[model samples]
Target: MASTRPRDGASDKGAARSADALLARMTRASAGRTAGILLCAAGAAAVSVALPAVLGRTLDLLLQGHPDAGRALAAAVALTIAEVVLNAAVALLAGTVGARSTAWLRLRGLGRLAAAAPHGVSRFSPGDAATRLSTHATEAGAAPAGAARIVAAVLAPTGALVALFVIDLWTGLAFVLGLPVLGLLLRSFARHSSDSVSRYQRVQSVMATRLTDALGGARAIAAAGTVDEERARILRPLEELGAEGRRMWSVQGSAMARSGVLMPLLITAVLAVGGLALADGRISVGDLLAVSRYASLAAGLGSVAGPLGALVHGRAAARRVDALLAVPPLAHGQRGLPPGGPGTLELRGVGVSRDGEWALRGVDLHVPGGRTVAVVGRSGSGKSTLGAVAGRLTDPDEGEVLLDGVPLGTVAADVLRTEVGYAFERPSLQGATVEEAIAAGAETAPRERVRSAARAAGADDFVRVLPQGYATPLEEVPLSGGELQRLGLARAFAHAGRLMILDDATSSLDTATERQVDRALAREIRPGTRVVIAHRLSTAARADAVVWLDGGRLRAVRGHAELWQDPDYRAVFGHADASGGGGNR
Candidate 1:
């Protein structure tokens, strides 16, 4: 069944505020690099505007056969060279800033993902997360450089208009008359293209997520004879993506075409007016030449569409990245745990809800130090929820959980992590080698202790047979279900804390291996409170106490021997008699 979490009215507003703050933070972080890029771009723009006027003067000097023609020519050449140098500098600086910004945003996104609660991270598909970190981050990073180009693009035309007005008022007025039309075209393009680009990106993310899901379940799809259907489903979003792409192209193409036509008309009109002015002797030949060039420059303003589009697309991408960053992380506390305390655990009237349904309700239980308690129940009976609360993997919606009289919510993160260890049914051991996986999170453990932990989990023998033994990379060692479970157990055992909660961590192992592991855990590992979520009746029977949960409520908390006396308790394990005493172990 799909779970539904209740939403608060303030959540949307809060998320918007957080996203705005994140955008501001990113802008601040890239400020120094952005400034450098802008300076180079401005220098290039200034040279570009000055070169035409200089060239005009040089042309006039040669036309009149003046002695200063040589100096005028030299000045034009120097300005051209300077423009080239400035442009090269801008390109270098822009690339540098883009790369740095991408790296920075990617790192920040990863950190936020790490800090978020498991459920929050689970909301994003792996493929979607990858796209955000890579594609979206890169696009968003380009905004600063794109913004600098936009400023330069705007300045070129503005500067040209001013120079034209100073040289010849009639030519300048001709150029200015076309400005409103160009502005209108650009404004329409921006509006339509922004929406289209945003939609394209969203559809791309959806398609990637569907493809990833299909790939992960390819074996199941093949077995079910639904490969074709799955493929079709994954590609379903492609049509929408294509439509959006076409819309963006059409908007950009239309704007560019309009600019292309208008630019030539404006330039021709300025030349016609300049010709009349030259004929009437209202302006010199040099002034006519400068005005014509400035008119062409003003027309080039239409080229702003490309950089402006990039800036808009980048802004859209930044919003997507910020959405991920805004997922609220689990709050931690400031107090540390007392040293050397017993691993006594207590739950006082705890309740938890998921998707608007109570997963656990008004439950209370306690375990003395150095004792093993097995949490057993039917599926959806809150066994996992109990274990999660015990270890502070999550907090209860109501009531409180305490470790040695210290509220779990009030315990500092470092102290809580060091004192409470957890091993999941499917552990993600992110390490290069078997040794490293076991030693992860327990980097201070001595070599001997690592070996001892591995041996206790019955993993040392299999690990030793590998090519490099414990040094063998995990990817090189393809492990069976039981072997993988053992490795996970070994890691948790290596970091055995004052409280160890195993959430069905040993379910993959065979009965014999499980027995050996249990014996080793009792004999070798440090004494601590052990809370095991169990399915087999034998596991519960072997524990010091059994916590039976039913319908999100605690049914009983007693020894397995005492609970087994009830027929209903026996039925919980789907047993008529105790014939299959081990409960499918």
Candidate 2:
């Protein structure tokens, strides 16, 4: 089910605001590099604008047989070299800033994903999130440096236009006459290109999402003999993606084509006007040469569209990246758990809804300190939801949950994490090594404590037999489903506090191992409240009390033997034996 989270409705204004804010933060993070890029770009522009005029004067000096011609020629060559060096510096600084910004953005994105409630982050599929963090971040990170270049990009043309007027007013005026056409071409391209770029990105995101989903379910696809169909489905968006890509190219081509024809005509007109000025004795040969160069520089205004297009792409990508980072994080407060308090977990009128359907509603229950409570229900009967609430992994949409006397929402983030631990059906070991994975979440899980937790989960024996024992690299070790669950259980045990939630965490272990782990929970683990989301009847039987959920509400809180009398409760295990227990391994 798609969980409804606290993200904004993805309104255009909201997304733009978030994108701008995120870009601003990136700009600040790369401030030094951005400043350097701007400095280099400005220097390059100055040299570019000055070099043409100097070269024109050198030509005039040579034509007039002036003694200073050699010195003027040397000066022109020096300016040319300086321009190349400054442009190279600009490129270097831009590259560094872009790399730095991409790293910063990725870290921020990952941090937000980690800090948010799992369900909140779940809104982004693995593929979509991966695309946003990797490709989209790279695009956006290049924007600030790109923007700095735009300043110099614009300055070059404007300065050239001013130099043209100083050389000959008629030539400058002739070039100015065609400026409106150039402006229109760029505007049209920007509008069309921005729209096409945005559509292209959406298509890419869809394909990536489908491909990721297929990879995750590759085994299912293979078993069903539908690998071919899956492949086709994953590439279904290819047509639209190609169409958008072509549209972007067409926009760019049309703009460049128009500019291509218009620039030459404007330059020709400037040259003709300069010739007439030379005929009228209004300017020297040096001034005419300078005017012609200035006219070409100013006429090349069409090239601005290229950088503008990049900025547009960057902004669009920023919106997508910010969408993930903008998910409202689970808010934490300043309160901490009182020292030496037992974890008495209570849910009062707690209700959680998914996709507009209630997963749990008005399901109030309480577990005393140091007691084991098994939450038992049929599939989709809110058992896991209850576990999530008990550990505060997710907050109920309505009402409140409290541990001891403190409200969960009011607890400090670190305090809440330290006091609550969770083990899920599919545990993702966090660290590189086996022992590190087991100790990942604990505030302080020393080597001895890690080994103890592993022993309690029945994982120590198997772990020690592996190639490197506890130090074995997680990826290099082969683990069965049951072993995975044991490691997950060990991780929870290592970090277990006043409240530990095993949410269908032991479903993969055999009955004997499961029983041993259960015994260890009571004997070898911490003395605190344990909320076990159980599917096996034996698990409920071992708990101090059982919380039975019917539909979305709590049906009863009674002993397993007492609740077994109800045929419905027995049928929840998919068996008719009221006296017989159920198990799955």
**What TM-score, to 2 decimals, does candidate 1 have?**
0.93
Every model's Cα RMSD, please? 2.9, 2.4
Candidate 2 runs further than 4 Å off: 1-8, 576-585
Instruction: Give me the displacement of residue 40 in model 1, in angstroms.
Output: 1.0
Clashing pairs in 1: 4-355
lDDT of 2: 0.87
Name the 10 consecutive residues with the lowest summed lDDT in model 2: 1-10
Q: What Cα-based lDDT does every candidate model obtain?
A: 0.84, 0.87
Q: Compared to the true structure, candidate 2 yields what TM-score? A: 0.95
Deviation in Å, model 1, residue 527 alpha carbon: 1.2
